[model samples]
Target: MSRGLLRSTAVFSAMTLLSRIAGFARDTLQATLFGTGGAMSAFIVAYRIPNFLRRVFAEGSMSMAFVPVLNEIRERGDKAALKDFVDHMAGALCAVVLVVCGLGVLLAPAIASVFTPGWALDQPDKFAWTTQMLRITFPYLLFISMMSLAASVLNSFGKFALPAFTPVLHNLTLIAAMLWLAPQFDIRPFGLAWGVLIAGALQLVLLWPALGRLGLRPRLRAGFHHPEVRKVAKLMLPTLFSSSVAQVNLLVGTVFASLLVDGSQDWLYYSDRLIEFPLGLFGVAIGTVILPHLSRRHAATDAVGYSGALDWGLRLALLAGIPAALGLFLLAEPITATVYNYGKFEAFDSRMTAISLTLMSLGIPAFMLSKVLSPAFFARQDTKTPMRAALLTVAANVLLTIAFTTPLWLYKVEGAHGGIALATALAGIFNAWLLWRYLRRAGLLQPQPGWGRFSLQLFAACVVMATIVVGLRLWIGSWTEIAQPTHRIFWLFVVIGAGALSYAATLLASGLRPRDLRH
Candidate 1:
């Protein structure tokens, strides 16, 4: 059982790594060509509003609600019922997204005003660009939402590869759009908005045929009044905020960031992207693979199996998240300067980006832990607990943002946006602790043996790894001074590779074995 779960996660992570590599290229090109200027900031805001909703309505809340119920119906051996439920779900999801997308297009200007009222007032051109791009990108919610439904069905059916690779195509499309399509448009950056719309439809189409292979092609049936449909909608409500706390907090940060400099939003967006690398590679892969497993274990009343899966997820989270956080925090400046300090992106922009990236790196372990913990509640169809956690976390984030950023904004301090990153990190840690305490109180998480030894091994490994990385950084000074970009990239790899190997060797030398991870 451990091997199966590990294999699935490995497969998913490998595919996601390719997508991340593609995304790296996309961002490198985007930063080089556009830089963190008024135009790119406009694109970031327009893209973010829809992307945030995609997480809320499509990937985050929607998947958590739909998967366990699908597992339940599958457990009961009810093919007809499953088909009926899926059809109604498709129609119902589409029906709602259509209206939402329509309203989004109609109110693009007002919506942009709300998120960035500062821009609307101070930079009217940026605001107009935001409204224009938003009108193009708003329909992406409908396409990506349907694609998520298809992905949920495929995941439950144990076909993980196709859905995992869809993002590869998504990124590739955007890269092509930037190179070829951007110049063709009147406003060159409008091509990025068009790229999003095209990519969403392409991904949905890519996943649709896979469902037919499983005999689960959903023929749309608007059974909004259907009991199962209503059940899913009800299950979806609390997760609306709970499953997407990070995104909600970032959106809040966007509001505050608008008051800073022109490219403040771009800096936050790029730094958050850096934070998501290990997160998408390991954290998301582990969470996605385990949720259905936990749901099935719960359906069978196999408490032992459920606990074991949670334990595995928790251990893996710490194993990957800690080293990732340390690496990002230690190398934030070099990494930023090497990748993005070309074309229009200047040293000033790199410095600003590194500030936020360093602060946000502190939240990696917490973000990963919450990813594992929230699924524990959702697997049992208990969404309200995480929702409560979500509410407090966001509230705390707002208060913290105000406390942290207001003083900086008041004083006209440089890099004021880092305060937003700091608040987001602190709130994430608070949320993870709350969920951990809730799970203990509810008696859902029974810690397996060796937690003490396991934690110690991780601590020792990280300490060794950090020492090596810092020494290397101090020896190889002045990353941005290298005339050749390839030289900088090569040295950066050398540093990362050494740290990774040092970490693994320390673990093995400390008596940690591969078999320990499996069982």
Candidate 2:
């Protein structure tokens, strides 16, 4: 089981790394074409609305509800029953998502107003532009939700690679749009919106053959009365909030950010893109790969296996997340300047974005740990506990966003967006704590032996990596000051390579081994 878990995690992480690279390219083009300006801020708000719902339903809520149930059916080895349940879920999800998409399009203006009240009041044109872009992007919800359902089914059957690779398609599509399509459009960002809509259909289409190859192709028939359908629906209710709490927190941050300054939303958005690299590459991949194993352990009533899986997940999260957070924090400025300082994304924009990225990087462990911890509850079919934790998280986020940002905005602090990022980081810590407390109290998990030594070794490695990165940064100076992209790229890779090598050497000297990851 441990070997299989490690293999699956490697597969998912490799595919996710490809997707993140493509995502970075897409973002770089986006920054070059449309910098941190009023239009970009509006586009961020517009894009985030549908993207939030995508996370809420497809990535977060539905998958958490669907995967465990499907795992159970697969474990029973009842192929026909599994197919029936999948078809019913397809019908139900399709019916519901279609209606939601329609409403989203029709209500685009109203939704934009609610999400970006300050923009609406202060800059009606930007607000209007957001509504237009949002309408075009809304239908992405319907198609991508179906794709997510398909991906979840594939994941249950141990077919992880195809689904994990699907985002590469989306990123490539957006990059193409930025390069060619955006230039043709009157409003260039609208090309990005169109790209989103087109990519959604393409992703769903790509999944069809994969599902058919597995003999799990979903047939469309209303299964509103199906027992499994009802179970998923019941689970999805609480899992909605619980699984998507981070996105909800980001959305809440969007609300606060809209009122801050002209480019505040764009600054926050760029920082978020940088932070998502580590989160997507390792944090989310770990969560995705662990869910099915955890579910199997829970279904078989193997408490020891379940506890072991959770422990393994937590350990990996720390191992991957600690160095990543430290590296990002230490190299925030260079990364932002190299990746995004172009066209209108000037030196000041890079500096502002780095501030937020630095603060958010401080929460990487908290964020990644929460990813693994929440699934521990979901795999047990216990959504209510996570739902409660999610509520506390959101509340803390809202209150802290207000608490931290108010004084900054009141005192006219430049880059108040950094305060919002700090609030989010703090809230993530609180959320992770609550999740660990509840899980420990319920006896769902217990820390395995060697955790103390493991933690010390990981922390020591991170400290080494941070020292190396900071020293390299001081020696190389600002990426923004570099005249040529080739020079910037070369030095950036060098810094990253030096930091990675030092960290690996530290781990080796501390007696960490490759096989230890399997344990």
Candidate 3:
């Protein structure tokens, strides 16, 4: 970790913190307005349809393929060539995304039926609502995909903070819409869906001035025939399949959960939102900064630089992610109760969400590790490897979901939410393992002497943090009742703050310092 890397990480982490805070506010509004019910389930289903595509075509494959190539051209060619590449890719992406989104709108019913059959069978009205919402929000995928491309350009140029902070605006827009517009529309969740569109537009608009500042004026042009455009298209095909497989796993979980009970899908969605807060803040922000840096190092054939970058990323992820995971696991009930026990949400709902949160916390490291390791392959232009790993993970997810859910369904378990959580955890571990193995086999990760010391320190810190969190929870167990949201809220902060202090003190005692991060 050089000073430059540490500085970049700090900026990214700060932006991610803001984004996560706004995201929490957005989730709070949604939970209060719809609770864990059909409306919320429908909204999750509808929103996920476009979101899946956005990740696949926009942020996932496109960024993976486009950024490195852009960096290469910018390194070797002149400014005019880089500008030409951006304009061509932008036009090509728009045409492709528009056609795909239009098809998604036309086939919403069929798509929704396949992904969420239980909604179609048991709640036809909800199914129709989801279809309509999907139509309204699907175009957002197009705009945001373009936005992601623009952000990738800015990021590769070492201009990261603005693009990284863009999600804060997205979340703020949704929060405002939920607060102000939901009441005006008698349709409840429709306003939230409208907010999704507005947020996507805002995200795009917010990036343009930044692009101008970078001296790149992207225009819609017929650059589809450019050789570089074709090269990107060639890489994108397998990458798209890989991205779709990951999204399909989520749809599978949603469909399976929907079949189990009325609110199962919503419960899982809310719990996922909680886990995503840290995932976005730490895993995604780190991954965003690491990729371009790794790409440049790999291009320069600096194996030591690449390995050091990966090491620092993994270390920082463990530093923040481990304590957060432990805290979430220990205070799941209190945290859920505090954040979501309002309006239509009730005590039992909090318990269910807490169970899901605990399970998700167990998988947080796997999720973060996958984010850190996958960049190695992406930097090397090997999307197919991750695609293979993703396929295996999805298959494992389906198998584990069936195995866990069937036994619970037969035995009449009191809380089947745990089974979904366990299945997802297992799947995530499998995904992370495969990613690590592939990266090692490809000669991406070199053995470093300090890695063992770093791992030991991280494990020790996690243990100390978990012990403190559990001890504090036991000490305050009587005060934090799931039925009393206010009490739970009070204890939630106390327990978390105490645990965080304990972890930080332990890390400092273990000889880890801010200066140690500077390689």
Ranking by TM-score: 1, 2, 3
RMSD of 3: 1.8
Between candidates 2 and 3, name the one with more favorable lDDT. 2
Q: List the residue pairs that clash in candidate 1.
A: none
Candidate 1 residues 1-519, lDDT tens each?
A: 777888898988998999999988998899998898687899999999999999988879999999998999999998999999999999999999999999999999999999998998899999999999999999999999999999999988778888899899999999999999888987778999999999999999999988998889999988799898898899999999999999999999999998898889999999998998899999998988999999999999999999999999999999999999999999999999988889999989999999999999999999999989999999999999999999999999999999999999999999999999999999999999999999999999999999999989999999999999999999999888877999999999999999999999999999999888889
Show model 3 residue runs off by greater than 4 Å.
Answer: 241-246, 410-412, 478-487
Q: Give a tens-digit lDDT track for model 2, residues 221-287.
A: 8989999889989988998878988788899999999898888899889898888888988899889
Off by over 4 Å in 1: none
Order of quality (lDDT): 1, 2, 3
User: How many residue pairs collide in each prediction?
Assistant: 0, 0, 1
lDDT scores for all predictions?
0.93, 0.90, 0.81
lDDT of 2 at 406: 95
The worst-scoring run of ten residues by lDDT in candidate 3 lies at: 477-486
Question: Which pairs of residues clash in candidate 3, taking residues 3 or more apart in a chain or in different chains?
Answer: 1-519
lDDT, candidate 3, 1-519, per-residue tens: 467877887788899889988887888778887787767778888898788888888778888888777877876869898888888998999999989989999999998898778788988988998899999899999879989988998888888898888899999998988889777887888888999999999999988778887778688887779988988887777677454444566666877876776778778888888998888888887888888988888788889999888877777777777777877888788788788878888778878888889987888887787778877877877788888988888889889889988788678685675787788877887888898887788787875567677777777877887887788878776432555666776777778787778787877888888887776
TM-score of each: 0.99, 0.99, 0.96
